[model samples]
Target: MIGTLLTFLAVGIVSIVVVWIVLSVVGSLLGLTMTIATFLLFKVAPVMFLGWAALKLWAWARNNRGFLSAKDRRWLERE
Candidate 1:
């Protein structure tokens, strides 16, 4: 009876340790993926999107006068 109880205790401890390791590894991977995705969304996406929008607006204003001030039009052309 004593041997059986000791074996059960050992198995339980081993199972707990295995579970903890698996959880930690998976959690770290998920955290890294989330961090990279967040960086791209907040840092890179806005810069690319805003740059594209500015170019499109400049083109539209150049073709359609009176849409933007003469000074603003000159600035766009200068750039």
Candidate 2:
């Protein structure tokens, strides 16, 4: 019957609208997550890299020169 068909059409339209709204909300949330993740990566990467480099340098220095001596500490304390 025409009434049944109309009812189906209306239900289809409502469902489509609801699905569209849900998809858009999900899309926006995904975009926000990506942006925040990228921002954190950029902000944190340099500090992390520098820290890693410093650790490597310290290890190298420790291996090459050994630990700081008492003379070195005394010289530093003089200043």
Candidate 3:
């Protein structure tokens, strides 16, 4: 019957709409997760580089104390 067909069509449309909404929510969450990951990477990258630099400097100072003057050594030691 036409009434039964119309009812099925309405149900189908609503089901599609619900699925679309769920997919949108999932997409937003994925985008937010990626944004947070990138933000964290940006935040930690400089600290990582500075740590590497400090390690390099320490190794250099250990092997070549004469390369740095007494005042420079004092300043590095203070840090």
Each prediction's TM-score versus the true structure? 0.65, 0.71, 0.59
Encode model 2's per-residue lDDT on 1-61: one tens digit a residue.
9999999999999999999999999999999999999987998888899999999998898
Q: Native-vs-model 2 lDDT? A: 0.93
Displacement of the residue 12 alpha carbon in candidate 3, Å: 1.2
Show the lowest summed lDDT stretch of 10 residues, model 3: 60-69
Give one clash count per candidate, in the order shown. 0, 0, 0
**Model 3 agreement with the true structure over 28-77: per-residue lDDT tens digits:** 99999999999878988889989999999999887786577788889999
TM-score, candidate number 1: 0.65
RMSD of each: 8.1, 6.4, 7.1
Who is ahead in lDDT, 1 or 3?
Answer: 1
What is the lDDT of every predicted structure here?
0.95, 0.93, 0.93
lDDT (Cα, 0-100) at 40 in candidate 1: 100
Clash tally for model 1:
0
Model 1, span 1-79: residue lDDT tens: 9999999999999999999999999999999999999999999999999999999998888778756778977999998
Top-lDDT structure, candidate number: 1
Better of 1 and 2 by TM-score: 2
Clashing pairs in 3: none
